[model samples]
Target: MGFLQRLGSAFSAIIAFLVGVITLVSLLLGGNPGLFGDLPQAADLAALLALPAAVLLRLVALVIALGVLIGIANLLLTHAQRLMRGRALSAALLGSFALTLFWYVARAGDTSLLEAVQLPIESSLAALLCLTLVGGAARVIAKRADIWSLLFVLSLLIVLLASLPWAELEPLRAWRDWLLRVPVSAGTRALLLGIALATVVAGVRIALGQDRAYRG
Candidate 1:
């Protein structure tokens, strides 16, 4: 049994690696007949190469849709059981979900219900978040009276003040725009690049059968 398991794992890893390589190549090189220069069958070759990637993408989308449906069914089932056990919160959640779903279907997919409820809740959460940030900045300055903390608080205040719709705060708005356009943009790009690199590394590890999860 142990030997068979290892063999199966090896087989699975090989298949995964092959599929990953094929998909990557198809996505990168497919549907670009110009890349082949003046080859006689360039268009035909490109189309052939693109076919696998197209099919794979559709399969992925279908799987995601199915997964979402399964998740919703599981959520309802769990909440229904909880409701039966007199869990008020679960009952309320189930009732709300049912009402929202029915409302959506009855209105032929009109999103007025969502706009009425979700928009207000999101706005309230954003207000709370701003308050929380201000409080956290104050605590940080109190705990550590350093230059970095002062700069952080100053930037936070400037941003908050700039958000107000007053003509007098034009200078702060200019500063905010510069901060967002320069430092914030650079930092965001750096973070995204780092994430992309990490993802690539992890993907390579998996494709090479070096990932522990795939070893099982």
Candidate 2:
């Protein structure tokens, strides 16, 4: 760590430690003393966690929800195009399929009533950037009998089908629950453990001014 960086980090650590101690003390003393007062109850709160949208507001609500989908496609297409330029067709196709699939899973988090949406003006523009790339990649990989991407895309298609309107995807929904309850549940616990360990290490390193990330 550089001298100035160490100095700044030390200052931040001292301030943060003091603030945290003060917060705990305030809570124990039976009074809210922070800048913010009471937090909203979970039952009273809107379904949006990642969205700052107030569902009571008609237009703002629509914009924030739709904006999540639009922003995801825009960010993903940029990287997919770069992969396409490198003629990494497998990577490109897999990237597109994965990006769409993950975003679908996340945005659909607990909302079961609505069909997944794709805006023509936005989706067409986004798909145009990568679908052709995926096609070209598909052809090239076919010659080598490479079916990794082909398989992934097909699996993603099945997942999409499971989410579609006409499909009695109740079975898929059950499978989704199982996926979370079985592997995903365990994996998340493991990931949290990993994150906790990393946090402790990072905290120690920062306190000792050995973290390069904090130096900046």
For residues 1-216, write the lDDT of model 1, one tens digit per residue: 699988987789888878777887888889999989999999999999998899988998999999999999999999999888888799878888989999999999988988898899999999999889768888989999999889878877888899999999999999999988998799899999999999999977775557746553
Candidate 1's C-alpha runs over 4 A off are: 162-177, 212-216
> Residue 96, candidate 1: how far off, in angstroms?
1.5
Best-performing candidate as measured by lDDT? 1
Query: What lDDT tens digits, residue by residue, belong to model 2 across residues 1-216?
Result: 799977987887776555444433333332222323465543233223212222224565688999998987786677677776885755855654676668769887643322343355567698797888668767755765557667555544555566766656878867766665776689789999999999978865553445535334
Candidate 2 accuracy as lDDT? 0.59
TM-score of each: 0.81, 0.31
Candidate 2 stretches with Cα past 4 Å from truth are 1-158, 212-216
lDDT of 1 at 183: 84
